[model samples]
Structure formats: structure tokens, C-alpha cells
Target: MKNSIFFTALLATTISLASCHNSNAKPVISNEIASIEKTSVDGNTKIQVALLLDTSNSMDGLIEQAKSRLWNIVNTLTTLKYNGKTPDIEISLYEYGNDGLSAEANYIRQVTPLTTDLDLISEKLFTLRTNGGSEYCGAVIQDATKQLSWGKDNDNMKLIYVCGNEAFNQGGINYKEAISDALKNDIYVNTIFCGNQQDGINSYWKDGADYGKGKYFNIDSNRAIHYIVTPYDVQITTCNERINNTYINYGSHGYEKKQKQAEQDRNAGSVSSANYAERTVSKSKAAYKNDSWDLVDKMKDDEKAIDKLKKEELPEELKNKSKEEIKVFVAKKSKEREAIQKEISELAKKRQDYIDTEAKKTKTQDDLGNAISTSIVSLAKVKGYSVEK
Candidate 1:
């Protein structure tokens, strides 16, 4: 009877082990299925782009080319894939030379502010017309830098394409300063050098782009005019081919090793710990919790450090003894604060001046557009056709 009981216990243990293994295997399969679903959902990233166009009299053909190719550019961007992920691109257009007066006012008018609606962008592009003026690239950059809302979020990539036939260094504002500001705001400027100019002219634009952390394209005038419907194809295709070749040359084994290392870094525990610490510190500083005293302590320490560094410092007897001494210290501190406040006030005034200048320029541009539309209507009337505003 003892031998039969022991044999029954061993049989039950073996069945239980088999059932546990089957349950674990089912979960592994479910996790794999869920991962596949996630991969499909996270495939498309978004891009924000701006086109700074030159509407100078010399760019009539360039404008025509751009209109013809606008749809093609949108289609190409929509279809682009990097590492099996598509990029949804949004575009904005701004035309220089559209404003007939002061060159400073001829900057970007939001045309479209980063929207995925390609149809609307295309329609606006088609409406752009050429006018006569000197291209002030610095003004355009300054205008774009200040007016356009760019880089509001980290995931979006902002690009500016400055297309013009003239030299980009003509305006009073420094090109390097404009470019630096754009880079600070995370806006990349690409140059499309057009017209019958030497390669040296292209170099100037290239330098400006370098300052802006952008790429430069030297497009021959003839090519720009003739290849209107697909101005970017040759360059885009070449870039894509080079990228593919580089990836293939690196071999799958090498790529996998690099990818695994990246994954490990992303998942490391130290990163999570640092993020938690930051959150805790932020929460602890909330004023409603009566925690502002900690900030006051920091300020006191800062003031003590400054006092310790002073040369020919006031003797402790003089410092602590009289109301006159306390008054002098308080007055000195007040003066220092006043100086800082004055500097801030000056900066605010400068910013306001810039805004006022831009506002005046915008009014001029509006008037120019209205005048052009009116002139077109007049011409149509002379040709015996009814024109509608």
C-alpha cells in the first residue's frame, strides 16, 4: 500500500509541471502579438516646413515652376518612408517682393502654419504671383524668426526653404545674427540659389545656411525653370540612394548590435531614477504647500556669498550699529536692483520697436496685394471680361 501511494504522488507532480509550462508559453505568444500591433500604430511621424519664396520680377519662371511642382512636392513628402515609417509633412508659404514698398516689410505671412492639409497649401501656392523688388534676405529671416511660431513641440522638425535669385546679404540686419536666432529656435534654413549668378553668389547663401544649421542647394537657373514640376527629385533621389547604400553596406549583424545597445541605454534604471528625482523636486517646490521658505533660504545664501566677496567691506561694527548704516546697505541693494530692472525695461522696449516695425511692414504688404488684385481686375475689364473680387 505505501509503494502505490508514492507512485500516485509522482504522477500528479509530473502533470502539474506540464500545465505550468503551457500557461507560460501562451503569455509569450500574446506579448508578441501585442508588440506587432504597436509597431503598426507608431509608423508615421510629423514634419513642419516653411517655404520663403522670392517673387522678384526675375523669378517669373521660377514661380511658375514652383506652382507646377507644388503638388508633386507634397505627394513626394507624403510617400517618403524612413526605416519603414512614413512622415506626414505640413507646409507653410511666404512670398517676398509681394510687398511693393520697404524691403524690410517683405517677410513671411504664415500662409499656412504647419497643417497636414496639402490641398490648402497647394491652392495658396498656385495663387502666388511675381512682382519687382530687391530681395532682402536678412529682413525675411528676421521676419520669419520673429513672426512665425516654430518649434512649439520637440517631436516636430521645422525647416525653412529660402528660394531667391538675388544675394541674401543685402538688408541692414546681420545675416549671421538672423541665422543664429533661427537656430536657437530650432528652425533649419535651406537655400535655393536661383538666377544667372556665379557660384560665388551661391557660397554667400551657403554660409548663411551654415549659420542657420541648414543645407544649401545651388540650383541652376535653367534647371530651376525647366524642371518646375520636380525641382527636388534629382537631389532627393540621390540622397535616398546614398542612405540606402550606407545601410546595406553596414550589414544586419552590425546594425542589430548597435540597435540593441541603444535599446539598453534607453531602458537603463539611472534614467528612470533621474526623471523621478526631477518630478519630486518640482512637486516639493509648490508655493501652496508653504515650501517657499526653501527658496528664501537660497536667496539668503546668495546674498551672504556676495557680501563675503566685497572688497573693503564694511566693518561689522559699522554694518550692524546704526540706522544710517542699514539705510546705506538697503539703498545700495535697491540701486543694484534698479539697474537690473532698467536693463530689462530696455530689452522690452527694443522688442516692442521690432513689433511695431513689422506691423507697419505687414500693412504695406497687404496694400500691395490689394493693389495687384485691383490692377488685374482692371486689365480683365479692358479685355472685355467680368472680374470678381
Candidate 2:
């Protein structure tokens, strides 16, 4: 039995089902986030994944599944270690086939570039809306391959997951040529057909996966995702709130960004308590870095970051303080954050152990999260990576 397929979903799986299919509904998250610069951490090895999701009227379930499983997928990826070193993991999202998008661009939008900002990823994931439009799989694949800043390191793991129910070869651009370009960059393209297995094969979904040297899966997108409640859940979620209080916000948009962090916490909980706990575990990991705004994390990348800050950039609490005073405050917050994260990490391990033991009693079903999580671990092993356990 696979480690992730069962234990993972109990941590995976939800979103506001009511508005998911509304074509005219506006994005729940603000679109004024353009001024924030996209940032990444320098690492010897990294794992980059691009999610190309179909947002046509009929594929609303697919979008919901992606939202429900985002944290679980992140947690699963964090378990991988390459030669005992944790690789920086970046996830990029793209939405295609939404009528609201520009037709000149083939109804596709690059929601975000690859980044380690898990909060930004969650914000974008929640804003995805479904509308009637054409799903050009080939074009989306080609754009993602060229647009995103894929790593050049030989050991970097690059992957693309395109999920849709439409015919694979629907657009002017040939799927074969697009996947070939992805292969040139050492990127594997996986296909998730939102229907029957044989139906997906009939639509050439399997061939697209084969052409890219990746896995192919078929799933019932409309089925509700199931989760396992654990005894450690309440304790872990309580820690999430305590950890949030440790973040010291800075910069012009510091306060708003901090609020967004709390909002994302609520969004995860809205899905289910299990998902909320999984997200807390992800926040405790290294990949959830927020150095761009959070002073605690910002100081890690540059110890003298306080010296570079303008008086106006400092938050209200730090405004009138001397440089030494500010440093002492940030140091205190950082220490608190570290202690809280440690507690959450330890609890997370116990939570997973409980999940694993209970999972053996039931059968596992393949959903968006399961398919991605299982493949991530398996592919990482093939690239000489190992699970921390």
C-alpha cells in the first residue's frame, strides 16, 4: 500500500461549493496584489510544479478538488528530501477555458508564476471561477512551459499537471509539440482526465501523458472528497492561531498582507477541520517562507534588513523605536515563531501516525490530491530522493 494515497487525503479535501460554478461571480481575493514582487529562495535542488486546470462551466468540480487538496499536496511534497537536503518547492497555477479570460490569449490566464509563497497560492486557488469556454490543452501547456521560470539545475524535479474533461487535441497547437517542448526542459507532463479511464484514453489523454513520459489518471471530478478526523486535530489547529500571532508585519502593505494570512487560515478551515490542520502543518515547514513582508522571516535572508527599512515602512509598533529596540522586538517574535513551529511539527508527526494506522482499515480512492501526492513521492524516489520517515 502507498503511504500517501490514504494518509494524505485525510489531510486533503474543500471549498465554498455554492459559488464555485457561478460564471459571473467575481474573485473573492483582491486583484491589487500586482505590486508585490514574486520572490524565491536559492537552493541547490528544487521541485517545480505547474497546475493547468480547466475552468469551463462543466469542470467546476475539478476546481473545487484542487482547492480542497492544495495543502495536502504541499505537505506531501515537503516530506521529500534529496540527499538529506530539503529542496525549495514552488507551485504555479494556470486557469484555462474560462469565458471571463481573454479569447486572444486562448482563454488561458497565468494566475501566478512559480513561487514558494504558499499564502499567495491559496489566495489564487480560492479565486478560480468556472465559466463556459474552450479548453486548449496544448496552448496552456506550451505557455506554462515557456512562461514560468523553471530551474536549470539537473537535479531539479519539474512537473506539469493538466486536468480537464475536453478532448486532448482540441486546439490549433499540437499537444505533441507542446509536450515535446516541456520534455526538452526536463519537465514531465501528467494528465488527469475528469471522467472514465477508457473515455480518457479514447480522448487521447493517455497518449499525452505517454508522450511526456508521465503518469495518466482518470477521476470522477463530481464526487465529494472524504477526510479522516484525528484526535490531534484540535491541538494542531489551536497552535495555528498561536503561530499567526508571532508574525511581525512590515513594509507598506504589511498590515494587509498579514490580514490576508489570517483570511487564508479561515479559508482552509472552511473546507474542513482536517484541511485546516494540514495547512497549519505546511505553515510550520520551510516552504511557507514569507520574507517579502513578515519581518521575522525577512530577517533570516538578510540580518541587516532592519537597517535598510525606511521610517515609514516600519509598522506602527516599531515606528518610534530605536534600531536596537526594533531588533530586540523582531528577535523576540522570531524566537516565539520558532518555538510554535516546533510544537506544530511534532504534533503533525503524531497526527500522521494516527492517520496511517486508521487508514489501513479502509480502501483508498483516487482524487486530485491522491493522484498528485502518490506520483510526487514515487517520482521523487526515482530522482534519488527519499521520504524523511
Candidate 3:
């Protein structure tokens, strides 16, 4: 049961080409809006994901796999479209079973709330540390369902991917109860058993997935993650550096997050050049937005957001400029960003082709990356999202 609940692995090695709806697509808000509700009425659809991982002593490989393949997941998600409209994507993270966590809280921590900033997700994934402790699978699942602001739209995709290395019945809370609550929230709960498939089935991991109306995956967590280096990698990586310079930093953490963006680039590069480059492709997609810090993204979120900004709050580059000057400056940067992102999106298609060709010759190990992606494809179809390759 312990082995089945966590990842088991052996090493071996690494989507189709899909263009995000045009890079110029914009989120349109309804003209008829009540005074009380404006932010919630955007035309953009959404895919909300809650990731709960067991961080016990033996799960180090699982965490590493997450860090390595995070971009590929984003890369695939960028292809989603329904009626030619793209969806907003948000992800939340949770860790359980590390001895360093609060004991009274059942050794679980919500590492980050649901957020659209993919870089912050990558940053948080890199910061996880494993320690010995009990993994309360049921309790953690329930917490995410209750705590997160899940979408009420029946068409939106909502999911919980909770993985652990223990008996499904180990925790005090009932796994059935957790699944019931998830059902109430219209959220699908997928279970990834970290060990052998047979062992996972015997331990009722498959049954848990059944009750939750989600996919059942038994992944070998110990497997080494491999990123397939592509011909377009260099050009894609270079474009990301160019795109980074276009961001106009403002607010308190504006400059800080801008640097952090570069820092994560280095962090991804540390893993492998291919990994870093793949991250850039994901960043190029429409899903990667930083409205909280970058003026470019802020304006995209709300065209009127510039009026809310005080002149002193502007970045040094725009501080002395009048509102009209700042508007023109931001518009120019926004256009430049779109062009760079368009180039990256085009290159990403070529990169995906190279990966698909390579994958046919060599079967990549079915690990966390494949598991999550496979489930995503299945659920996405259910939500009426079509993939344009």
C-alpha cells in the first residue's frame, strides 16, 4: 500500500502542434453588467486545477518530475479552444506528509492558492522539501474542495489531482466524503497512485478514482524526467529574453517579480537547456499572464486600469510621463509583446512536431507528466474544448 500510494520509477526516454487561437485574441466583457458584478462576467472560459501532492520522505522524485514537466503541461493546455475562444487557466498547489509541516493541521500545507501566474507555480514547485510523515489523502482532498473558489459554470473544467503513497483509507476523514463534496462542487478528482498499477488497484486507488468520477493513474515516481531537445529551442529561448524586456514593472513587487521572472528562467535553465526553452514556449501562450505586476498584463485585464494608477506609482520609465504618454508607451509594449509571443507560438508548433516525431521512435516512461496530460485531454474533451493542431 505504501509503495502504491507513492511514485515508483525506472528511467527511460521522452503533444501535436497546436496554435493558440490568434495571439491577438482579447477577453470581451458583456455590455449589460449589473453594478454588483463585473469582474465575473468576462467572456473567457476557465480551467481550474488543484494539485495535491504527498511530500513525505520518499516522494522527492515526484516533486522533481513536477518541476521538470510543468511547461509541457502548459504547452498542451494552450491549445484548448471552444467556439474559437480560449479559456483562462488557474492552478493551486498543496503539499502533505512532510514532518516540517504543522502537526495539528495533519501535516498538510496549501503551498499556493489558485493563480494564473504559471511562473509562481514553477517557483513554488522548486521550493518544496520532503520530510518523513503521514500522508492524509482524504483530509487534504476535502480541504482543497472547501477552500478554493471553484467555478460554478457547468462548462468550465474543475479538477483535483491528489497523489500520495499510502493506503487510501489511512486518514481519519473518509475518502468517500471528500469525493461527495467534490461532486457537489462539480469538480473531478483524479488519483495518481505513485507505485505499481497492480498494487494501486489492490489498495483501492482505482476505486477512489471511480467514486470521484476522475481518471486513475498508477505512475512510477522514481523515473528520471527527460526533456526532448528540439531544433527550435535556441530561437524560442532567445525570443523569451526579448519578450522579458517588454514588461513595464509597476507597484511594489513589480520590479521584484520582473527579476523573479528572470530568476525562474535561470532556474529552468539549471534543470536542462531544453527544459528552460520549453518554459519559454509556455510563456508565449495566451494563458501566461501577469496582470498583478506587469503594466502590459494589467492593461490587458482592464483597459481602464491605467486610470486607477497614480502617476507616482508608475515605474521609473513611465513615472514622468503624462497619462496619454504612458498609455501610448504601454500600447507599444503590448503590441511588441504580442508579436514576440506570436513568434514563440509559431516556433512552439515546430518544437511540438519534433517531439512527436522523437516520441514515436522511443516510448517515454508513463510518469506524472503523461498521467496529468492524459487526464487533461480526456476532461477537456468532456468540456467541449477542441484542439487545433
Q: Which prediction has the highest lDDT against the true structure?
A: 2
lDDT, candidate 3, 1-389, per-residue tens: 23223321110110011111222222121221111122232446788888999888888889888988788788777778877888888887888776766566666666656667787778878887677787787877877787666777787889899887677776677888878989998899999999989888888788888999999998889888867888899999999889998999887667888998998898888888898888898878778878778899889868888888987678887888888888999999999999999998889899889999998889877988889988998888987899875
TM-score of 2: 0.90
Score each candidate by Cα lDDT: 0.43, 0.83, 0.78
Q: Which stretches of candidate 1 lie over 4 Å from their true place?
A: 1-45, 81-85, 99-104, 107-110, 200-203, 222-389
Q: Distance from true position, residue 356, model 2, in Å?
A: 1.7
Worst 10 residues of 1 by lDDT: 1-10
Off by over 4 Å in 3: 1-43
C-alpha lDDT of residue 164 in model 1: 78
* Candidate 2 backbone collisions, by pair: 14-68
Order the candidate numbers by TM-score, best to worst: 2, 3, 1
For residues 72-163, what per-residue lDDT tens digits would candidate 1 score against the true structure? Answer: 34432433343344444556666664443333244223344444434334445555655566567776666666655454554445667777
